[model samples]
Target: MIDNPKIKTIENLLLNKRVRLVQPKNGYRVAIDSVLLAAAVPARTGDKVVDLGCGACAVCACIAKRVNGVELIGVERDPIMADMARQNMSANGFTGRIETNDLTNLPCTWETGQIDHVVANPPYMPANRAYLSPNTKRLTSCVEICASLADWIIVAQRCLRNRGTITLINRADRLNEILSTLNRGFGSIVVFPLFPKAGRDASRVLVQAVRSSRAPMRITSGLLLHEANGHYTSKAEAILRGAPINL
Candidate 1:
């Protein structure tokens, strides 16, 4: 049994309260990025989806609530966070799996080219570019300590079946680098930008691709998350409230 009573944790609701997750109170809480990452994935019933660097498993639990019949697995490097992930999954009644292993060295049970869909909200900053958080969990979650962007993409490429979908949300400034890494094996790529407001440049982007598809890359008209008045756009609210988005 997890000794969460001794851990600094908080309960947060997502998907309009359809799901609840326990996250570290101060270190690396669930944010809009994880929620948007879960929303960007287009998974159907019976699909097998794996979340890389799953943290407290918020993305997987959110996806499980939204997509019925889909199988979910969360891979997290930190054992404490992984244990918390398991607790959150059970608290939310999610039957999906959680693996406390580094994404670069996933267990053999996750066979190559078997996953139907893969989603990740990888560390947005390069390890050398920013000040590392003193909190270990936050540090690993925000920087490429355990895995690089290329490493995450490589693992996704190896795990996805032919034509399987892989989706990611990352810093918008790194779109070029993210695309270059995805080019190794992913195609039919689509980039969806997330603007902070109606006319602002995107702060984040959601990128989706097929494992072995040959379709041309495209950038869609992106999502404006907020209005000039500081309220969430209706569309953004719908998605945050668990409305399915077709990516």
Candidate 2:
């Protein structure tokens, strides 16, 4: 892994944490949704956790701090991000629990039911609608390039064990697509809508589904992220800050 490239960008962790990511200004950068997904991941001691599309390995870093006893593996399609993820894993002294691997066709090395939990913050936009980056490597992994949502979900299904949980964050308008895909494979689902503030419609949603469960879905109350004055609510602050969010 090449050394962590010098960068000037800053990333805010929702709360205090050991792993602080120094985002490279030029490459693929992670966003608040990634932080939310990482914090919301249901992890248990010794759980085998895998992150799909781990840009710069940031989610794994946050997971290292928030979740205990999870042996983390980050799967990236881009070699640059994959290498950067390796370096990031090493830099944060998480080499032992975290590792990076690139499989152009995701779920390449994983066997059925091997993973306990899988988390993905997929490209929000569709391929044709997104603008390609000038950088080819960065282009390949982002939705702005053309990684299909179906491809990502199929890979997630292959890697997760029966009854394993799959968590995802996606654009609010795409909830129907995400739910349809999950229902065909896994049954039990919990969807939480995320709103920018009270009285505003949610623009994003977090989905949690278990493989092969036939239970009814439980939709949680909307998670209001901010108030009218741009202040975080108590519940929103808890999840954003990496505190346990029990819903």
User: Estimated TM-score per prediction?
Assistant: 0.96, 0.87
Q: In every candidate, how many clashes are there? A: 0, 2
Per-residue lDDT for 60-144 in model 2, tens only? 8877777766788887765555666777777677753333444344446665679888898887877677687786645665553
RMSD per candidate (Å) reads 1.7, 2.9
Residue 244 Cα positional deviation in candidate 1, in Å, after optimal superposition: 1.7
Model 1 residue pairs with clashes: none
lDDT of 1: 0.87
Residue 109 of candidate 1: its Cα lDDT? 47
Most accurate candidate by TM-score: 1
